[model samples]
Target: MSQLDTAWPAGRDVPDVEKLIRQTREQEQQPVCAYIYDLVALRERAHRCVNSLPDECKLFYAVKANPDPQLIASLLPIVKGFEAASIGEIRTIRGVSGDVPIIFGGPGKKDAEIEEALERDVMLIHAESLHEVQRIGWIAERRQQRVSILLRINLRRTLPEASITMSGRPTQFGIDEIQVPEAIRLVQSLPFVQLEGFHMHSLSNNLDARLHAQMVATYLQCVQGWMQEYALSIRYLNAGGGFGISYTEPERRFEWNDFMEELHQVWEDYHIPGIQLIFEPGRYIVAHCGYYATEVIDLKTNHDQHYAIVRGGTHHFRLPVSWQHNQPFEVIAVDDWPYPFPRTEWRQTTITIAGELCTPKDVLAHEVDVEQLRIGDILLFHIAGAYGWTISHHDFLSHPHPHFYYINGT
Candidate 1:
């Protein structure tokens, strides 16, 4: 059992799910697959996440994680703002978010996107490269306005225990740290762009609290030195969110208190008047508020290996496949086995769970332990609120899309 006292993630007995299934079956709707998000839980989760942070910090929801209008609307009141990766995300946030600050980020931003950001007056544009800074200055100069910019710095030192490293290596994310001085010089030459601060979003999915704290400390040290070197006034230090949620061992999770305490030290050590610390957390904020449900279609033993096939495949839920890790799920035992034939019994056995697809790469959970599985049991995957449906291939094999439902938490 995972210790989730404040946040209720599992959809084992959520009312909306029962009602959704009943209504869908009543109207002869296929219970192929559907993603249910508990807005109340999401709101409460957001509160818990932001409230735990220090006053010197600001929490911004990463709209690229869910981007559901309802979810965004629920979080608007709780979060300080949103971090968007594309123009579509900005538009999506614009519909539900009123007057909330939005930060536009992404490596390959279009010229039209710069126009839209200027038109919308986004909080700032994170310049990933020198060319982007020049383009933004070009656009702002034509508009007779000065656009605030944050030079995204790819750090030279790498942090340990991160699942994915974006800024740690020389890849397409931000300006290399060695080239920061040149970028700063270019910004100074541009008349329409004002350098607000630095953005160092290095790691992704980092679980260790100590290492996470060390990464923040490193960012603070790097930014402080750069500000002193260039004689620049830094406004915002955007430490891009990379908090990790344990999918396998839930008992051993990220230590929030320890991490926050470490942040308190960093704030004291790197104290600069009026410089705000911003965190854009996506997965940690909303991952627990969603549940992906699919009905069991077939149960068989293929070549002495038990396999459980569901109505939905990796097409609808691809997080497990994307991470190359088996997603953890709980069995929602529905006793309504309608078939007449006696299903094969697999007591105390492990099975491979997959979806109904022609190819061999449609696995959702591999080698999962199951006490018993019948014809019509529902499999509910936890920690799915973040990148569950938004990142999936929805139209493979022309299968009907799954029904989406937003439910309550309590």
Candidate 2:
């Protein structure tokens, strides 16, 4: 049987992740610090999301989440396309699959990046500002080519708040809703640019399923209003994704099925014929499939608070520290003690899991209660697939980078 079959015999909910972690630990000679990815789990999750999507909606993987080449390759067949925020991300996706559809979206895009996007014949360039639309037109005119684009709008309407708010506020992301009329006129006047649609991406890491559906409905309502008032002949409406992965409460996940049910109602109400809906989600797609494993090197008490310093810290997996939340972790007890002295053990205590960094801010989990933790035990961080390694500052302390391992179950 494959590792997946051995680990997940009954269902996906019950996985022997510890078995895989133990296997990875046994291979390392020194203190282990590595990232373990379950490709089977990733594919399963992607398939679930793809299956849940409505016929009007197209799923695209945002490359900013985890741009691992293997991860990108794995997601290519499952998602409709890849959404790249930078030229480097575009190149990274291209390196994985040359002809796969790509949509470039970001603020303050360079002229060269626009030219490159035109050269690549991307599905759409999400234009942030009217000036950016002008620049795209200029570059396309210079290249003697016509480029398709989606005007990314910063709508003025009140929006549901998220951890990171990209629009409906003063942000350097999209064009203001009031200025969208001028933008429409400019796009219509530009001979080299074909205005394909509108891109309204507002929130990041939004968890409420009903509220999320309502938000998408609100976006559709706003876009339809613009289409009627501006007489815009648009064929695509990109409602960017911000599906949340609950780090604080892992069991309470975002209800995609519930979201889908409400989304069907929204589609029935607002989906225009011949217009496609696109959702570019990054974190929710791959977070549960990854594990960051670090070996504990020290156990101490500072100011009557227990602490466990591991071989790696925020330098390797910085998601916990970046989001200011105690990431969920499981202790894999290792009995082998190589030291001449007795192994130090911290028992039945609430321990703060910290990395080997010199700074106090390098903690991963604070005041987390554990049954029994020792110097030789390993801490496996859960839900670390997306925005983990890619978002971390690896070279901060000039420490060694963690090893990466993938279980394809083939």
Each model's Cα RMSD? 2.8, 3.6
lDDT of 2 by residue, 137-212 (tens): 9998888898999999998888887889999889998999899889999999999899999999899999787888
In model 1, the runs with Cα more than 4 Å from the true position are: 1-28
TM-score of each: 0.94, 0.95
Worst lDDT 10-window in candidate 2: 1-10
lDDT of each: 0.83, 0.86
Native-referenced Cα lDDT, model 2:
0.86
> What lDDT tens digits, residue by residue, belong to model 1 across residues 336-381?
5556888655668899998998877899999989887776778878
Best by TM-score: 2
* Decoy 1 TM-score against native: 0.94
